[model samples]
Target: MTAVLNAVPETSFAEYEALKAVLDTASRRMAITVVGEVNTQGRAFAVHVATLGTADPLAPAIGFFAGIHGLERIGTQLLLDYMRILLCRLEWDELLVEQLRSIRLVFMPIVNPGGMWSMRRSNPNGIDLMRNAPLSAEGQVPFLAGGQRIGPWLPWYRGRVGAPMELEAALLLRVVEEELIARPVSFALDCHSGYGFRDSIWFPYAKSTRHIAHLPEMYALKAMLDGAYPHHRYVFEPQSVQYLAHGDLWDYAYDRVRAPSVFLPLTLEMGSWLWIRKNPMQLLKREGMFNPIKAHRTERVLRRHTDLLDFLARAAYGAPRWLPQGTSRQHMMSRAIELWYRRRRA
Candidate 1:
């Protein structure tokens, strides 16, 4: 843990400090690895990957990622709060102990530290990490919003053509490939904000409207989430349902990995537009568009998602119980088609 802290810049970064504190507390109980590093203006940022629970190849895992877009600090804060809770409960939580025995938990809470530190949506190089992948959208995409090589000065800049991905993006995929993709089944949640008025849980094939091969699996997880929290208001669907984009890192990673090893990468768009509607003044601030500006509002947002994170942990631990099979899986597939694809067909 000392080594991890040493690798990070000595400068004060609140999110980094919180992450270090959580890792420090859980050091004795988990494995911590400094996966990679990013440097911006002479200050180096460490990308740490922490793993909790059994390392059995057969066990399911969940990878929690936030802060890919640095301006969306709520996503990073939500993850930090969740990790803080988990670390504090380590001594007395027997269920958590049991959970650790059957599942692997991976956290990469601050993937683009430089962007966060600079209060920019893109990394230090001005490239959007999410849009820096090698893949391109299959059809016509919405100008810059869909990503472009128009250059880094503009928003949604997809890095130079044929160039390698940004360091943070590369590191994220490396961590996912090593920690989560190696398992039989895994789900990754990359949290973000500023998409729409309602919260959403989006799964991939962001490059096209084509359904991912694991739609049934995704639907089963959605069903589990819905059944567990009857009144929850998360809209679950494919990313293409809203808009298609180029170089979505999750889509690239999901495409690289094949079936039998189900890797469902989901993006949790936290609906910061609702927050903006409540406080229109937030529009004036650079970070305002993507995060809740009020302290109480931020806390409420943080509190709201802990249950979802815990549910994801439990879902990974007990995937076999509700993942669906045979006719049940077919039913989920049919339902998913009706729910997500019907509009496209219409």
Candidate 2:
């Protein structure tokens, strides 16, 4: 499992601070802390959380909560990619600089360690961190809302039974309680993958299509993002909420913690599934052997996602506060060119 994540070292904890070695990220001005850890096959796995800038306990915060689904490697990659550049260039970017002066950012890249190494959709305990969230009903059993169509019976099923934040969720909440309380994130973007639909974005706990007071602002943010990402636009979809699924992370973000969080599950569902369908453990094989092309393409694709993610993180950092205009159209056009180059090779 550790070998699968070629970039991030395969590691297990012998002590609480074992992760500190890998946490090249900072503290104080920038924070990197271990929010949770889950045991798998007798090995301890830790969840590392980070922030781009100073954490103002009083000012509102914006955050990215991702990778609750362990198999969704892309989500964690995107988060880490965003953080890599954000940690450094933040001070230079006018918008992000202002955001740092005014507000804070919360980045929880890997919300489910147990599931990631195991290459399973759910945690070691078989709980989908995304669905394990507490429902609004408080103490009541989870149920469908609006027009949702997902449940435990599905592939990404929630646990047989447990409270919200039952395991990973609870650790995440504790992190929020201790660190985000001062800022209490006003906005959250949770990233995932597998659907591979035309880059879509869904808002709030449910997709009922009801007008959320913040939709305008949310759309505004999307529109600004669309400026550079014309080809990449929110699909206003998923039906994960209004369509089906009770214990989804989006709902938990809204109904449970009282934050406005949108779910952006980037489904780069390329044909890898086709090969994997023939052999479920196909990806588990050495990249150099099973599918060298995919392995190479995966690295390249993540580089692109990393670039966009950094742009988005910078944009989010500058929100409402005033961020400098993003890279010029020429830069984006060049990016398009790079995509074509890769596509041509593919």
Candidate 3:
């Protein structure tokens, strides 16, 4: 293990090492699985899924995913930080232990380890996993930024037309299906960075401007966040509000699971621009666009999202209490349309 950890050049596999450390010392409650493997540069890396809490299919589950984009190391780092905290808390935090017994927590903290190792957005094959799903946007999308079929030489390259989903993307779907979608109530929070001036929490329908079927539930979740943390700076909205994209894995997953269950998949796009704004010199570095370059700023970013993660866990644990229904659902749907979709049409 030590030799494997040291083999990677320039700490490229540091996140993997940290994940291994957590797995090495994880409590019996945590079950670790390697869902897939990627062999690159003569070194093989495993994509891990760590699951905790109840095994009952009816139990609500919340999944925390990060490191989809290889350049966004901060997301992986923040998640690792939170995982370490949770493992330590399991030792003595009685409330957390009790909460875990009723709710399931899933972590896939490094979804694209090869991409991170190569310091590129795409995996070893150069396919963008986020855009590798076999789905397309409903209408027009933003040029190359939306996903293209040109080739892997360019960024946002979706795999060949009618091609199978990338291994990493497929593994992610399998985990979500087996662990989350099978349940009646589940939430997925996929962490990301490198967009906008303020932190944003985005829901599905990246394929179109149309509101998802669960807009009311999404609105209630946003409202819960607002009521609970009024000072939060996150802009909760649909991914379409910013721009449309093709083959969004979350959109595909949400569509597949929406019929018989409630699955709310959220992408937390942390505002890396703010970090660059504070330290304009970060522009000179490729990673600076998607991560905080300084130690102090990185620590602050890690601390900032801890509350949001905790809230999601608690919200999932007590989803029945806050999930709106009937008249309340209708009212929230109306307000959500007004807040998210209606104005855009005008």
Candidate 4:
């Protein structure tokens, strides 16, 4: 049969089921609720939420998600991998478990279920969900889209001025409003991919605002993330302004709540190329997902898996600013010791 990860029927199901499991575990590991969802194209998509370390419901939280664009399947898969780690790797990451016990972790694994099934970037309506966030009354993509020049949403289809959330955004923002934002969250992150971009941990309104007070925290967090995976440059900044990404998820998060929000485009830096073998855009029918890799096996990809676990564990357990340092160096050291032992044995 076709090789897929776990019992995940496809990447879409992987997102759905992972959220279900995370929500279900909240009952045992923390306090949570279904939060709710909106069905598009007959699929029941939801934004799952959980609370920990307090009763104020509006307490600060750390959120993670994938599949907003739909075509960005790598993130969709990575989030799924995260769910499994959050659930099953409790022993391997006790510090992370303790951290989760302290800070609420909201997982919106599939923001565009319709797109997940179709392998498109936008939601089912052919709208780019990233650009679909709520916009100003004048209808712009926020301060970044194109300066005042690119008016009224074309080329981006950012959505109408007053449209609620473009589906998922509304639901997610609702959860934050009722729970995290109005309450206490001081930090949060949104995961994405593309550009094969390096050192891309970015903040909102990359160009305009000089909310410099927060730069140190951003750099500290960035250094921790970079240390976790040093293969790429640590490209952290306020994000660009020429793109004027209005109604963006990060824009809304930063502007409304003024939290230290991060948009991590964790693009893969390895030799692997997504479309080189099976096109990332290919659709799946009854015949099964086209040319997908079976769930990763062996240590070759173990570091990617480890990097994720480490990031979450560090976020949950270590102080928000600290991460394991010299991981690449540590690996080399361990290898050298092993080689020495082998030579001695010979």
Top candidate by TM-score: 3
TM-score (C-alpha) between model 3 and the true structure: 0.96
Candidate 1 regions off by >4 Å?
1-10
- In order, candidate lDDTs are 0.88, 0.52, 0.90, 0.50
Clashing pairs in 1: none
What is the number of residue pairs that collide in model 2? Answer: 17
- The alpha-carbon RMSD values of the candidates against the true structure, listed in the order shown, are 3.2, 9.7, 2.2, 10.9
What is the TM-score of candidate 4? 0.65
Query: Candidate 2 on 188-292: residue-level lDDT in tens?
Result: 666665433234456653433233334334444555667876765345432332244446555544444434432122222222343345455655663212221
TM-score of each: 0.95, 0.66, 0.96, 0.65
Report the C-alpha lDDT of model 3 over 153-254, residue by residue, as the tens digit.
Answer: 999999999989988899999999999998889999999996689999999999998889999999999999999999999999999998999999999999
Query: Model 4 RMSD to the real structure?
Result: 10.9
List the candidates ranked by TM-score, beginning with the highest.
Answer: 3, 1, 2, 4
lDDT of 4 by residue, 214-274 (tens): 3334445555666767874435545542233555565665556544432222222222333
Ranking by lDDT: 3, 1, 2, 4
Evaluate model 4: give its lDDT: 0.50
Error of 2 at 174 (Å): 3.7
* lDDT by residue for model 1 (209-293), tens: 9998899999988888999998887998899988899999999889878667889899999998889989999899998999888
